[model samples]
Target: MSGAHAPAVVFDAVTVRYADSPAPALRSASFVVEEGELAVVAGRTGAGKSTLLGAVNGTVPHFTGGHLSGRVTVAGLDTRTHRPRDLADVVGVVRQDPLAGFVTDTVEEELAYTLEQLAVAPTAMRRRVEEVLDVLGIADLRDAPLSDLSGGQQQRVAIGSVLTAGPRVLVLDEPTSALDPAGAEEVLATLSRLVHDLGLTVVVSEHRLERIVGLADHLLLVHDDGTVTDGEPAALLATAPLAPPVVHLGRWAGWDPLPLTVRAARREARDLRTALETSTPPPGPAVPAPPAAAPVLLEGLGISVRHGDVTAVDGIDLGLAGGEVVALMGRNGSGKSSLLWALHGTGPRSAGAVEVRAGDTTVDPSRESPAQRRRHVGLVPQSAGDLLYLATVDAECRQADHEARAPAGTARGHLDRLAPGIPGDRHPRDLSEGQRLALVVAVQLTAAPDVLLLDEPTRGLDYPAKEALTRLLRRLAEDGAAVLVATHDVEFAAGVADRAVVMAGGAVVADGRARDVLCDSPAFAPQVAKVLSPQRLLTVAEVRRAFAAPPSADGARDLGGAGGGAGGSAPYPVLGGRR
Candidate 1:
């Protein structure tokens, strides 16, 4: 925590253009970060966030074979003259992909790998690893196999590994995208402490603004057209043109100039406490869905899957009726992915019963070949966007349409609904994770399959994108497409699904109504469920209704309108000081 107050990094009109890419990924990006402060960088996917970060450590033109046109310096080191390893002494980078950080067999070994490369003494390495592990609160997982730990644990280990190297600044990209809420909170809180107490310069890119923006001292907003907007964290988030949802609400409500955090939103919620004089919530339209008649049925008896010697899924029973929205819920490595793959015949299925009814015929999922199941089942895998290798987003959708033999116009309609802004000639693979996800989902929807399976469909999505996807899924289900989603986002599952199924250690432990299964059941509830403690309140919208009083609940003055949960129940937790 002791050093001269150094300028951490500077970006001088930097731009990144790859050999294969026609245009620059980053269009003249410029920014700066000072030592011992938290700076948050945000953009819609593919808006040059990755390119800008890569430029900071000289990974832009070096690892990517791109044209770099400007000077970027990190911690007094000219990035142009330094390779990644050479800059390791000054700048630490935690990549967007947690998987990218893995190098050794065990978590402890991975942490040690960097220290040894830096040629630090063995004793010092040991002490630094322990310090980082204790600070990140993942000490128990230090001995665990790196691949066996959950995504959250792996991410913590990734950050801890770099922090242990004793760099002046830490640069992280989308650090919490793959983590559950609890894990995300843990990582953010740790970073906040490191910035305030340990005097580490922290720069992070994230889509979950509600949680992290408040903790930042500086904020950078990147527009799709390559504009970099920077200012004090409160000013950019709460009052800027592209302010996030909570920020917009806080600002419009005339809350103290700008409320950055959720707790601060509570203090500005006075308007919501009054009963509404006239205005009412817009009527939520009925989402689209398949026909009410035909349904896909997946009545399972037992199934198991083995990768080498490991059994990913073992002996499980499940049912999926037509026009049903069912969520396959579990933590990482709980066999959720294996189950979805088993149903689609993509993964090895040792033994099990999976009956999918299409009209008069009932097809056994395990007995069918990959090609055969592809005709009937539509699958959107976890990390599904990684598989895209196409030139144009339009071409990506066309591939599915061609396979489906559906109308060519159906593909266009889906594209319009999903990503109207995407150029027809834009490379699908070059897009950001969120943008690619939209393309993938839109393509799959064009296939018109009777049964749909979405694996972690919400990754990389902002609050609005998540809501849009939920609406799409509800529509698909109502149309009689049997939809099952494998996800770590349990709160999302509870909102969009009629039934919830929990998988742990490769088996279904709980299954029932969304609210009963997620909120009432002790073992099956998500972390936020325990905190909210309200019956069947699966979303922030549902919780907000408690604040919308018409005439008066206790003869209070009617307040016509307030944003989000302003009128709802008191924000405080009634039990155990949890919220």
Candidate 2:
């Protein structure tokens, strides 16, 4: 046990290098995380964030076969002297890929697995399992098969399984990447309570800063060169390489002590909102109007999917025109992934007619062979790594090119564009989550199908990688392909999608322009839209463009001089309080 005044975790001149890689993943990184503090690790994808976290529990050197110099001490126990199993009682880790860590068949059983391994008494184990299930709001899924549960449910179960062990320090990588906005909020709230009420130190790595920034007490930034920096969240984020939309907006508006939450941003955005009262944001990219006789690139009629007695998709009719990007969103388990899989023809589909336009003939995708289907429609599933089986990145690319009958380096070209600098010789399993996702995306694009479906494509991507993906998808749309992205990321949707579709209870509940669908819903709105409500501004780039453009001659107002008053009340009711 650590002394009362000792830090929860300490890294002293620590450096870690894998045998395969030429450079160290972490280079002489030094930091300290005090007990009960919530430290968020922020960095670009594959920028050593995971390497830093793995070091906390000795996974870096012990399990990953990496060379570790210096030392990592957690709760007064040196990681060099403690294997993962030895540190299990003091440190609990929930990795980015939850399913990879699951060992049980059911939710309740999974939660009890960790406790059972620790030899806890049956009475205490049952109590701990119940507490974790209830705390994570997953008690209703206690008896559900782990395979039947949605990705978000699996994430909750993963966290619950760790919580049942009752460790003093918790480490999670992209914990809420699979969850909906509300679900992410609940999980973060639970973590906050654990930190404050239980004095549990938390070190988490997440790409979606908006979801976790407000709850973080400290920030650990890992640079591309493997160096690490730590400080207050706001201060570090103000100049960090990437930040949430709200922070971008705060920086754009010159708000001192940049707001980390929508509530704080709203409080500081009063005058700025008044300044933009008369300026309308520039319109989104123009989607060319399809001719009346043009065939829909992809169409689904009366689609119905079921697993046992549960209806995953219930007789839904949908269509996508060529040269369009659609965002499919909803609460976890609301049928988004199910719908995507059904459309792709691989998942369960009891009833549905999915047709894709192939040249002059329209063909049913479900009736086509996997190879034939790839020629017309392609899909990247939520678990992208599952599609990878090759020994190295070069091998995967080579196979993808061969399967698609494309140029030898075609897939590798796409991968470079999406996430540059990933070594070709590294094994797919060794790459970071985002890198693995990028590789799959590149492989799927090798066929260059007319219709593309991506489920949770941005699961592990940072903002820059997402921007690159956005550009790639836009290029695909411009090339007359139809793209459908099933995602929980509202900001990505706002920026990349031309249309938005919301699903509920296995049916399409809402469908319309992305701006209208996203801005109108409090739960689905992006941080910028939430900060500047009633303006329909969805992104920081939009706001920046709006402010940069010269005033129009017809009643347009200058951003700098629109609101003469020093202080003005927000036009809309203050949105919901802090999450």
Candidate 3:
């Protein structure tokens, strides 16, 4: 361990260049992370954030086969002299895709695998495993199979496996990306406890800054040009290109020393709330009401999905119409994914009937071949990498073009729009999680299915990538494609979905307009909504549009408290229409 006065980790003019890359992944980066501090690494997609974290454990040069100049020292051990395994006792690293790193089949076995490899005593290993299971709130799943666990559960198991190893420095890459809001809070709270109580150092890279910025002691901004800038969280975020909704709200409202959390933003939004009391926002674009006899593009009747004895999706009826985007939301393990898979005709369904209207014919996807099903329905599962089998990005794109009989560069064109600058020759496995998802999305778009299902598509996307995806989905909807996105990202849901469908305990609990459903739920509300509560504002863009317009004649009129009118019956118009 480092001395009391020494920093936990240090980078001295570090530069890493991959064999295939044109420029250095990290160029002359230097920073020191103090002990017990939580440092968040933020950047655009494919901006070398992972490269910086990998350098700390010597994965850059030793494992990734990169040329490294300068030096990285962790816990007083120089990475140039020590490989990842050699520094295992001091540093714990978790990748964005937890399942990729998992070595065991069961949760208990996986958690104990690390300690057993370290040759810890049997009693100690057992005790540590139990402690981690409890700390991560996964004790009930201790004996469960890893394959059966939800994406969020798998993430917790991955974290638990590392914690049992007792590393001093924890480096997590998008640790909470797969988790629900409640689960993410638990994991982040556990990290905070470790930082404050155990004096452990944490360096995490996350796209959703809203969840972690409030707890971050320091921030590292990895620019697109491969340079890294480090400072206090608030100082860096003030001018950072990528920011959460709360920070955007603060900047829009011109609050000095911008607030990073909803609580802080709400505290500073007193005057703005008062100003918005009576001045109603402009109305949204008129949505053409569906005719009483409008035909549903896709319909599921009595859908029931089961895995072993567990009921993932109960009997439920759902319908998707053309030219609509729906956000499927629920806590982790809440049947959202199962329903998507069942609807796509790829997962287990004990009892259900899925019918899709393609052209003039109504067809059941389950009875069709994989290729036949693609023409009517397409699905991009949570593990997007599973869809790729080619050696290089170019090969994957070529295959997708051939399968869909699309133009030669059609898939590549979609990819370029979704996430620009991905090298064609790069192997699919070598791409980051966000890049992999983009590749799959591009491949699926080649089919141009009537209905598109994406599960956790924003798991690894940065803010810009998410915005691009939102625009793509919106365009697809406008082109008369029904889109269903299963996600835990409330912010993305608020921005992209016209309708929100919430599931819980394997059943549909609520379904309504996105603004009404998202703003009404405390657990699912976005930062902007939480900050500007009772006004029903869902996004920073909405708030900006509201304030940009001229104040109404009755702007000073008070309609009860901040809620506006009795029983909140008055409509709060947000920036609407196709986002």
- Candidate 1 off by > 4 Å: 1-4, 15-24, 27-30, 240-254, 257-260, 266-296, 303-315, 389-398, 407-413, 421-427, 490-495, 509-579
What do the candidate models score in CA lDDT, each in turn?
Answer: 0.69, 0.83, 0.83
For residues 262-344, could you state the per-residue lDDT of candidate 2 as single tens digits?
99999998887887777774434433355575458989889999888889899999899887789999998899888887888
Backbone clashes in model 2, listed as residue pairs: none
Worst 10 residues of 3 by lDDT: 560-569
Work out candidate 3's RMSD over C-alphas.
Answer: 5.7
What tens-digit string does per-residue lDDT give for candidate 1 at 1-579?
A: 122544888777877677866667777777878888899988665667777777777888888787888778887777788888788867789976777668889988988898998899999999999998888888888889988787778888888888888888898988887776666777788889889988888888886676588799988887767667777988666544434445644554556666665456656654542222222332222322334664546666788887888888889887777777888887678888888888876667888867777557988755666445655677888776765777787777677667667787676677677656667787766666666777777667665667888888877765445556677777787677788988766545655787778877888787766656777665445433343343333444443443444435544333221112211112311100000
Q: For all the candidates, what are their Cα RMSDs to the real structure? A: 7.2, 6.4, 5.7
At residue 306, candidate 1 shows an lDDT of: 77
Give the backbone clash total of model 2. 0
Task: Point out the worst 10-residue segment of candidate 2 by lDDT.
Answer: 570-579
Query: Residue 480 CA error for candidate 3 (Å)?
Result: 1.4
Predicted candidate 3 versus true structure: per-residue lDDT over 475-517, tens digit per residue: 8987888999999999889888888899999999988777778
TM-score of 3: 0.89
Q: What TM-score does prediction 1 earn?
A: 0.81
TM-scores of the models, in the given order?
A: 0.81, 0.90, 0.89
